[model samples]
Target chain A: MYQFNLHAILGYFGQLPSSILVTLEITLIALGASTLLALPIAKARMSGSRVAALLARAYVELFRNIPLLVLLYVYYFGLAQSGLHLSNFWATILALTTNAAAYGSEIIRAGYSAVPTGQREAARSLGLRPAHIELFVVLPQVVRVILPPFANHCIGVLIGSSIAAVIGVADLSDWMLATGSEAFRYMESFLVAAVIYIGLCQGVAAAMAALDRRSRRGAY
Target chain B: MFATGSVWDYWRVFVNGLVLTVELSFIALVLGFVLGMVIGLGRTYGPHPVRLACLVFTESFRSIPPLLLFFGAFYGLSYTTGVTLSPFQASVIAMVLEASAFISEVVRAAFRSVDRGQWDAARALGLRFWPALRTIIGPQAIRVLIPPTIGVYVAVLKDSSFASIVGLVELTRAGLLVRETVGDSLTVFLLLSGIYFVINFTISSGALALERRFRFAH
Candidate 1:
């Protein structure tokens, strides 16, 4: 009979604190960098210039389609050949940022779209400069409306951070893989790893749900 | 570059890898869709235990990265069961299991998104439970289901790359082979990424077109 050993599984958590801290660091950095990149990409996507829109559209389509693993490999291996060598952490961060920016641009673009045409017109009617109108009026509402989806995307970033393991980053998944391999306790290590992921993802989802409810309450 | 292989020299290996990739993806898609439909329905309509099981399955798979699942299924199953599987079989099984969990959520949401009035009307018509679902609920639910279901296909395609870690000789593996042979890592990988981009782009656009047509038709 196959027995489930609870203590062995519980022992895996001895490594959890450090692994989770690394995972959280990756998620936060990736989300922040991606959001910064996404702002301009989203703006360009919604730009009046057809050329700008086309470039942004191509970028999103290209990056969003390719798997993050492939992108990671390309950055880690491909870029290295071109004399732009990056350490595993830098490579992972770059790939995650690139992937997140592509998706976030679309989310933010949808946010931009959600800001009603009337509001833009109202801002324009007030003789406010384009920059001022976007900065003061349209941008705020876009952020507000996009918060729920943005929260969901952040959750996505958190999950997507697991791909960092491929490039040899010592995130949670990498730790699980390493420990499992070393101990030859594949089932216990993997089950524990899966639980950690489930817990983290559920935490993210719960937080996002609360934010969504709060935003809904405040929405006009 | 250390060793050189002509494009023609590697074409056979590349084509073989492509075929295997396509086969793995198709198998995973069909099995995952069926499994997803069952679990999706169960989560929506099954009794408490069934629903909870489905929920646990979905969350467990959804949270863990596909790579971990691939590794776990390959080694963990072998370790626990003494029933060994070939790398290819293990890859397919792992991908299908992971894909099914995600597809289940999409399908369940699609089911729920259909109006409650549809169910009420079906019940009032005196049709039995199975017939009510088959005749009324299934058709409407499928129409709403197509877009997200296609989205799942795109997801599964991208996920197939993870199987390469277990030596599945897919597109990514093919690129790795080229890297090993030609020693030009950049060109080979860039080409592989382009291939993946094209495949995913085609699927995504096809799905989008179908979704648009469905919306217009309805």
Candidate 2:
């Protein structure tokens, strides 16, 4: 019976940067795209129009509830059949963005809701336009209120990027799988991958903590 | 379009997949809760090294994608140790590991939110550590823990779909199979999404109701 080889796994760390970079790229792009998408949906959610509200609600519920892997497959394969071929990178990005946008919209909407209605009314009493009120008054406070949850969502998107491996995206997970297959040192490859993921996540947590501290200082 | 198979065909596969998913989630949920409590408490009061180790474990698991963990357990461990695990076992282990991290945070937060005065009062009353915890801390902590615990269960249910990549044949895999056979990807996916919607919606609503009941009771 062969015991797990710790030394060989340590060696796999040499190739870690490339895989980590791919995963980061996917995460950042998806996060940026999803945040942009979420803003409109969040606004629509708060809109008085029933159709807009319903559409926003359905989008959030559907995307948030569905498994991301299934969504990726449907986008990759199902879209392919319809003659709309997206690269694995794009497909995974699309899926992640759609999924993140749904959840992000809810988080942002909650933040918006937390903004006192009197503040908006107060802004209106000053003869501020609707757009001006939203932009100059509402959005800044909403951003502050939602910062922590938004940070959590970003962490979620970072982790969710690992699903990209299924659609053949050569992110950290895919690289780990490939490295394991090639080196015939599966445990080592995976251990390296795991360490990298852990490191990255810790970095994120630290960054979020620092941000939270900074935000609190500003608030005070 | 390929001919539509008998209703029994898709339904049977879906039922099988659903059962596996539920089983996977239940096992992970139960195991995760236990492990999470241990780690959570450890984080709260253990020595520095123990707290650091638990912090590392929790953050890493929380940050890394569940799919990566699943793949790592399924292929990486198998390759390294030459010990093959069943897909279900691999998926469950990965899910438990991931769930434990989040659960630990939930539990740790619950523990912290309990007033320090309660502990002081318990000690003042001459109650010992374990007894004070059982009679005072545990009950109050449970109220804070239950809602987020339900949220984690729903998250696990949704995450179990990632098991399909390693061939566990869960709900998502069943959808893929239907798509492959019927050549109607959209229809299959839509149906699959509906199933997930129903399951998650029910869980969330049930959790909210329970939360409300608990709030009133308190």
Candidate 3:
């Protein structure tokens, strides 16, 4: 009974590119920031100090347990009440970054563990300081081992970034929904958004798989 | 900056919200599990074309943003079909689809985790495909399946908070309501986070127990 208007959605083609750009921008910013932040947290977690490890563990557990949307509410609206103004863009970036970091740290930590113990012993026997061992022995290998999961986490972040739309970020989801409401053709716009999201995520996955293959080939 | 009485009132509202979250997640878990089993089995054991179809289904759903599904159900379905769904209904549909995507992957992985020889063993014993799968492989796969499935459930519970965006008055939505009334977004959200943390932490700990049981039984 309902007439679907694909043209109505196509009318927004000019705007869709900008919205998609915003989404990619958010995804990259969140992914990069999360990876940077995760390094220290992963290091602290693996540190021998009990207090440091405990604090790191607590941070991961709390963030992983609580929903990212709830945390976004706290950071954006909650902090706003106390005069901490964050633009929609920065608010989304921060929340997604923090959330991604928790998961990234876990993945990176697993990568660190996966490196054989014999390698560590070799570095120790070579009279390397802890810093040298970490820099030379751990960093190179960890980067390679973590890439696959790290790429997976980036894909996860890319998908999760769509949540930014609900907070008025003008991301693809927001733009599509707004186009629908404005044009009174919700189905067309919504279908377009779904296609774009699925396409973009698959693109990331394909890219990651290529990189994974390249890394594996380089391993020999 | 905070009053005890008002805090208590907010607590009541949050508890109400938590109950809805639980109900929503429970429905999603059950429905998704059923669908996941079918998809997983089809992907793992069905013919080449059926396996390809299952692959497309699971991969597309998994790669798509869940918010897109919510938007599709709430807005697109309404537009194209002229059938309006309540926010809760729309949300449950999204949750079920998303959970089924992830759970199907878990199930497929569980199936692969079973020794390939188990199938050969069943066939060697003259058992039929259905009977062999039901009796020999099913129980073992369930053991491998449970921990990851619980992990997925925690994810579903957390994502149910996202349903609030579609106008479902679940836990996160209730937090927003309390923030509006009490004018204490920080305390209210932190309190809300505490509740979520507690519930998810309990589920995660349960996953550890399940994983341990799986290992011990193996």
User: Top lDDT: which candidate number?
Assistant: 3
Alpha-carbon RMSD, candidate 1: 2.1
lDDT of 1: 0.85
DockQ score of candidate 1?
Answer: 0.70
A92-203 per-residue lDDT for model 1 (tens digits): 8898999999999999999888888999899899899999998999877887788877876877788788887877788898888887777777777878777888888889
Show model 3 residue runs off by greater than 4 Å: A124-132, B1-5
Q: Mind giving the per-residue lDDT tens digits that candidate 2 earns over A50-103?
A: 999999998987887788877887788878878899899999999999999999
Q: B1-218 in candidate 3: lDDT tens per residue?
A: 44334655767778889999999999999999999889989999999999998888887788777777877778778768888898988898989988998999999999898898999999999999999989999999999999999999999999898888788889989988877777788888889899999999999999998799779885
Best by DockQ: 3
Q: What is the TM-score of each candidate against the true structure?
A: 0.94, 0.91, 0.96
C-alpha RMSD over true interface residues, each candidate = 1.5, 2.1, 1.3
lDDT score of model 2?
Answer: 0.86
Give the alpha carbon lDDT tens digit for every residue of B1-218 in model 1.
67887544687777787788878988998999999999999999999999999998988787878888888888877777878877788898888898899889988988888888988998899987789889998888899898888888888888888888878898889878878888887887787788889888998999999999988986
**Model 3: lDDT of residue A185:** 85
lDDT of 1 at A103: 94
